[model samples]
Target: MLDTYFNFLQNIERTLGGGRGVKYGLPSTLQKVIALFRVDAAEIRLNQPILAELRLPSQFGDFNRITSETPYTEAVITGAEGHLGTLVLYGSRQWSDNELRVVHLIAQQLGVALENATYFAQMKLKTSELKWIDKFGDSLLNMLSSLQIQEVAGRIMSATKDLLEVEEASIMLKDYESGDLMLWSHTPPEKDLSIRLKPGQGIAGWVVEYGKTAIVNDVKKDPRWEPAIDEKGGFDTRSIIAVPIILDDEIIGVIEGINKVNDIFDESDAQLLRTIAKWSAIGVGNANTYEALKHTTEQLADAKKQTAMAHMVLNLAHKINNSVGAVRVWAMEMADELKATPHPSMEMRLMVENVLHNAEETLLMVRRIRGATELRPGDIRPIEVIEAMETALQFSRVDAAVKVERHYEDGIPRVGADAERLVEVFLHLMNNATDVMNGRGTLTLTCRRAQNGTVEIMIQDDGQGIPDHLRSKIFDPFVTSKSDGLGLGLWMVKLYVELIGGKISVTSTVGKGTIFRITLPPWEK
Candidate 1:
């Protein structure tokens, strides 16, 4: 519509005898009126005067300086029944009434053209803004699926920088424990920047402290401007828009766009940033929730595993106790019959004594095994190391060919432990020694008080020592050299010993012997 009107003006100028054309190509009809009035210059104004100007048909020097003596006329331009602006002509000629009417008719058309052009430009600007807003919304939606707080924050900051056309942007979240604003993410990737602010410290801080949006057009002019940041980062901040990231009526953080490119920030920029801040808060909230849930799941899985292990231990203890009890009964009966024989030979006497001792130790071991499965803090007490070793040795059933010796210091302090659990530990070490010896090595048990006020026990055996490769992981579960062993004995032994406030260690040489040392805290009355 505006182009058609402009074409009409062009044809009018051609019809009029105003030489070839004018500088701004005024309509020939309007040109004839300007010539009749001897106007040197003409202007077409819209909404505000001087919005546009029409070229003169010929050189009309310095028309702006035309005095009252000069011939000139002013006419109002009306469009859509509303006053658009004025058409003013400066010249030195008399204008007839017919000529004046012609100018008015053309000025009215000019007004409509101007109005249409104005609306067109405004619509184009709005279209661009809507596109950017759509893109911004899309970017935020993508961030919603992010499970990492840092990733969400970085995306938000990058989107803000691009959408707002800012030189720098950052997201800062408050540290709940320390009451400080930690810079979580920023655009342009400032690897060396470590920004932390207290509440009410900087522009970002002010937004957080007040839970409001702030627009600083000139940092130097605003008293709230914090120069320390610029000085530290070597940046000159000319403008900024900071808005609080609010969640559930609480400000969790702040989003800031600094130094808008080629323009000062306005309320409109603040409004955009505020919208983005809302979405960012939601993204951060979702990410945090995901992380918390993941941690909880892992903890629950660990608890379940521990529960299963405990059940397995209890079941196995019950089965072993039943079988061990039967063996103890038969062994005791045979030992009694051997001792009852009159004038028994020395060898026969020795055999009977060994049988009796083994039976007693087997019974003690059965009790200990059962006790191990039912361990509790209240069942713990001070245990004499020598008595526990004696029971463990007898139960170990060391071969008659293997020499067994005991060296226990008199008055050695008792150790705080579960008696049955402690005995189980000794049984594991002795059994391991017997397997390495293959039924023909020396096994020595020793006990003494350590300088640390703890009772130290050592079980030394001259057997085919543990292979060097297996020593490091000997105490680990499911690690063993025995074909029939489940490999958990030493691991459990280590576990039980530690539970009773003790430490266990081993020293061994391949093809020679191995020594297992344990230190237990002394029991206090």
Candidate 2:
């Protein structure tokens, strides 16, 4: 009989969350319990405070489920929190005291197993919540760091709805213009975008007026509840969590979340809003300061303005880089965790991978914006006009009239260069050549060894050439002759050339043609 008990116990352990353990793994384990005990029937009845499972326990075919009046042996099932459910056994004969203990032992293990499973499930849910919240923080920081202040409020309000599981959230900035609070961001956005509130009038106003966070579970019971805004916006107010956006001891705005979608407002939601509010303040201030500096820079002479702008951008990039690093760490940790986990969801893995890719891309873009050209110098083979050829090839698809000629000398030396940037240099020049030719001229690409232990390349175009006056300033930032050009192309080409220890020059005529010559040093020993 003890052996039989051990086998049954082992069976329960085997199917703890899976097999017959309880329809949890124990669903079949419970059915096996009947056979092991030689009982006619058995049932597990759920008690108060359902942690996860909601369905009534199976009683098998034609067997009655346990009830208050049923005469049967009982084994109470309990978890860490206390009584979770009950296990009942029905038989043809009287049961002994020893048998009852074994029955209780089995029931106890089932309860413990179910409880463990519940906690694991809860942990996954919390992990998911934390993941999104971290991502939300990253999103907000990136927006603020980029000076995209105009879009930040709406995004914060909309995202807070999902973060707090709420319906109808808004960000309200204290309006000095009208001595009131103006609704800056609204979810399920209203047709009338700008709505104002009187000073200290509503819950949001009260937060700003008092310089504190507000957590209102029931707006109906709070005297500070303002129904006018709800009536005007055609939204209902149930629960509220509003936080003040403070900067340097001054409250600038309010973030109000109205009516939680599931449960009422809690301290956790208030705390999240508080953190977000601080970030929002930084965002607002950065946008204002950036604009002011931009205006001032515009007023300065060209040389001074370029130097000042470069400094400003590099500083902004440094700040943003630190924030972006945090995002990257989160992504990397998420990826490692996903990989370590057994049977991780495909969607989650893909999402983490996508985040990592985006973080790397954004980092590169930030560096680019700072005018910081990162390089990976290597022993690159002789200049491949392949990139320019590819561009010409692509252009050839559109117009068969344009002729492309590629010339390469057999003994060209390998150059030290960042190959990717080198490709960009050629692509940009080739694109210009194709554009100028206007579909009916010659685009020549040449690559050869130079006399001075260097590699030489040239892109010559036979359609409308650059004016001599413009050629001198052609490599200067924003100095484009094209009517629609931002003028950064030639500047970038010059920058890229110089960065890799190379040189670029150009000669052109107004009506004849243009040739861009580039020389790159040979790879070091």
TM-score of each: 0.37, 0.32
Tens digits of per-residue lDDT for model 2 on 1-525? 544555566556567632123345655676787777677677667675443342434464236544555567788886544687888777656676546656777776666556545543433455477865555654544434333456666667655776677877888887774678987777886556667878788888889889888999988999998787778777778888999988668878898888888788778888778766765666565455435433433333344445554466557678889998899999999999988998999999989888889889878856554442445444344544445446545634326677778798876666666555566677778778878888678888898876666778898998789877787778776688789986666766776677778899998988989999998887665
Highest-scoring model, TM-score? 1
Q: Native-vs-model 2 lDDT?
A: 0.69
The list of candidate 1 runs beyond 4 A from truth reads 1-136, 145-148, 296-525
TM-score of 2: 0.32
Model 1 weakest 10-residue run by lDDT:
16-25
User: What is the Cα-based lDDT of residue 487 in candidate 1?
Assistant: 70
Say which candidate scores most in lDDT: 1
Provide the overall lDDT of each model, using Cα atoms, as 2-decimal numbers. Answer: 0.70, 0.69
Task: Write candidate 1's Cα lDDT for 213-320 as tens digits.
Answer: 898888898888889988877888888888998876788899889889988888778877887787677667656654543354344445455446656755665676
